[model samples]
Target: MPASATKSLRVAVLADSDTRWKWGALTAQRLAPAGAGIRLDGYLLRGRATPTARQLQEVGVHADSLREVTGVEFLRAMTEESYDILVLALVGGGVQAMLHGLRHAWGTEKRPVVVTGYVGVVYEKLADGLLLRHGADLVLANSAHDADRFRAVYEGVGAEASAVTEVALPFLGGAPYEGEHDPSAEQGRRPYTVVFAAQPSVPDNRKDRAYLLDRLIGHARRHPEREVLLKLRSKPGEHTTHIEELPYQKLVQGQDPPANFRLVYGHMGEVLDRTDLLVTVSSTAALEALHRRVPTAVLTDLGVRELLGNHHFTGSGCLASWDQLDAGHRPVADEEWVARQGVAADGSYVTAFDAARARITELLDRPGPLPPLTPYYTPETAPGYLPGILARHHLGPDGAPLPGAPAADKAPGAVRQIVRRAARGAYRHGVQRVAPVIRRMGEL
Candidate 1:
């Protein structure tokens, strides 16, 4: 197959949340050959972290068709429809379950090239997550450092390491930052803006979150001339890729915020347009900011523990504290570290996906039926662990749909649909409203 060949490719992305959906959709476009037509379809996995309509809108990606589906329902769709590619934008267990189900469903038959990878930094579950995703046709590593780590993990376990392909983060393109505070700019200077990118569950506790919020408010008070924005992932009662038990939105209810401080929610890239300094504990938005040449900080205020995920940025030279930031200290990123982490600050991002594109083209151009999907963990290899993961998705060890799995595939009637919506709303209400009250009562 020629690199310039034009083919209309049908790509289906099964995403569990908004962040993953954005990553998957953009990656589908990036993986396709240049000038090729793409018909993208989306399947949102129904779960606690399933994205709300507003969350999907905030993602700002367009799919030709989009709908929510259960694990079994998605498996059925794969069996019935034909697609050139299937991107599993899911967790490790979800990806593993789908691999087994698809293997059984398409036995000896031609199937789409299945792809899966992490949405951002792989801070935890290094071995467990990689093994669960081992059967994927291409397990994309978003940086050179990750690719090396992935291959090392695979070979350490005596598994094939060829499927790990190096690629840059797909959602990393925006206008380069032009030194927003440059005094000699032709246009009038904009306000010096500091954006704190908030994650859902990094701090994961009320005390740490409130402390960070206070620091942000203090920063606003100290620099009244500057604009401080708390860039939140999702609103109250809405879930993103991770669950937010103690959202900053709720924490700021009674506190008095300075006029310069405010909470803003929109596309991260758009917010970065006027941002002078971007800060986070461990959010992937820091990478986005760095890619666009914006000064980024990964805070070490709480600690550099793995729980905070700030340890992943240890070598990036972007680690700093709120005290340092308040002192007008901007840490320069290490060029060598940035290159290894695949930030693409040097404009190498244009060709980052070339290898992935070529690999997909070769797979699509292959003659005859392709080989069966063989995952690293089999019934023999992981008798105790693999079955539980499959059972959660309504599949047996052999990937056959277990009894009553078809019930999940059935479309709900109008009344049942309404009831389902109400149930989800109640669940969110419990998480946001009731749970906090109960916790406080317990403390008292």
Candidate 2:
């Protein structure tokens, strides 16, 4: 087949870190062969506060294709460039920020289809509802439960219900044997292996990190034949801080973990490959583990409904506590609950690659009416904010501003990079340290 004969599908995936990258990669892979002439190219749109494209290199995300353009540049590209679709691989304020820019650049006549939706398991819908009601042409619902909720909510809110696409968990289903445990593998050699999927940012984990670590350590100590692994969200020196996630390493720093337990990082697939049992408070990783037929237990040690956010798993018959684990209680998988949640018998998601392909093809074949611009960003705000965005990026309708002087052309590049890094580091340090003191001082 001649390359030129194929129809090209150019996609811009705006991502800040690994969470969105996972979805972007999945979407790109699935849409790669939607039609006979379909040719797909996925580009990473990165900016300030985002994990650098280099950090995602290990996951086969190439740095070469990453565009470190500002919000203004993104708007200009969407308005002027030729692209089939643009996916905002983000949620909450991060998404609102881009929608603000898009409001200014969007035109009623010609533009690429804009898409975004909830990227995580929906514990609550209030915050997600606001974003989904924003101007996405296609809003992907991660599960049947979510899809139904999206339709009802959007319809009630006077937004288009047709925009919602019911899809399986994008992280699962497409990849075969992705998280299957392999006892014969070198890393899986332990008699029984357990992986604690940590979500450091979750309030329950942050408040009870020590208790959680102690519980895991005790489990390892009691079952000397078993090895327990703390599967960290990020590695020791890597930057996967998508939304300011606290790495679990900081929690276990001064204490000694048992010999049977250790910390590991990399792809979830590699980590889950050796996992016989999976434990977490309310991590979405439970879905991944369950999909692999690896028994999963949702820890209810710290107020299951109030603090842990594992309330959804309660009816699923996957709930356990540190006390329960200590008493040798392991949760049995409940098929009835699983069916209600729309999870398949083999644990594969209902939304397979074929379904994903069909959905993408359908959206591409029929680009819908342009979404309203001022849903999230008011017309008044765009006027004031758009210029600031342009000035920050040194961009204009013409292009990047011309050099003022010969010295300006030289531009101390390394110094700028160093200063930017220092500023970000200081800001993060302040949030971690000063914020607590300020709050305490206010209370006093």
Candidate 3:
């Protein structure tokens, strides 16, 4: 435990989507020193992917206080209240905007230690995303491999690299998989279950998504005795961390699935409890399955491409095709490879966040006012790029709220709240229904 174990801490998390909320909330709990009382306040950033009530409930993490707020609104709240730490669980643009906004808002006043990082595999937008998140006090890396990559990116760009800290995925905790041979025998034994975790936008096109769906159905038909589950991240019309231009639910509509096959929704951890074989095309659920010692596979049916993110598992020894899986192929994970990925299947999971906790504690114990939040991209450094990012959050070049920006201190009336919900519903309708139709029309 760190020296700050005796101190109580107030932490605030600002997240945009369900996955990020899960990551940020769990991370806050893990970062707190053992035996320290923590007051967690959650701020859900309002946007296209902003989680619905159902999504929030599925995440199953409760904070002392939780509310929805716009980016500028959040900045105002920070000025009115105080917290020991702030976890920015947002996209690169959002993090960058908040860093600048908070810099101007706090202005010489003591500020919280800001932290941010990816929710899962850092397989896309390596430089763009990392640089946007550059100014954070700690840019958390979920693995030693990620820590090295993060440092290299920062040092290569001549930016400060001290902020990159190694930590494991905070959400990777569940009962380890027991042996396949059930000692309890047939009377109490459950059927072998195969779960295919679906991502929102990995195989973005209809053809690739349809092909994967067909394969899942075929697998179900072949293995009649096994329970085949399509574990969906969100329901139709609901958005997650990523946009789903082509949802599996929609693609599976015309097919006649076998009785043994089903679409399951809820927590991934709960689904993993019954999973004998976990399959995916680079969903982060693969990491969760690996951490629990479950037999896992990253499909090569669509090719090992960066777009699919399966390229990240090149040496994991868990990459295999569905055809091989149907022939009873179970890929054995390489232990050294697993360790490097921070899966912690060997009971090393308990100490994964020690460094993060120690660092937070040390920062809290600092004597006087900490220096201003200095981001890598200033007006002089990224004149063209930085302005657009801040404008999206209603912030100006100097981080002050723009003239037309909504006043944060003003509370919306009953009619305004109703209008806001209706607008969001209309926006989702456009994404899930209208946009696909337009795309199909263009192809025609």
Q: Which candidate achieves the best lDDT against the true structure?
A: 3
Residue 342 error for model 2, in Å?
4.9
RMSD of each: 1.9, 5.5, 1.5
Tens digits of per-residue lDDT for model 3, 113-200: 8999999999989999999999999999999999999999999999999999999999998999985746359676788999999999
Among all windows of ten consecutive residues in candidate 1, which has the lowest summed lDDT?
A: 1-10
The residue ranges of model 2 lying beyond 4 angstroms of the native Cα positions read 1-6, 36-49, 62-64, 125-133, 173-188, 204-207, 235-246, 340-356, 367-412, 437-444
lDDT of each: 0.91, 0.62, 0.93
Question: For candidate 2, what is the TM-score?
Answer: 0.80
- For candidate 1, write residues 295-347 as lDDT tens digits: 99999999999998999999889999999999999877888988999889999
Ranking by TM-score: 3, 1, 2
Worst 10 residues of 2 by lDDT: 402-411
Q: Model 1: residues >4 Å from true position, as ranges?
A: 1-4, 182-189, 406-411, 433-444
TM-score versus the correct structure, for each prediction: 0.96, 0.80, 0.97
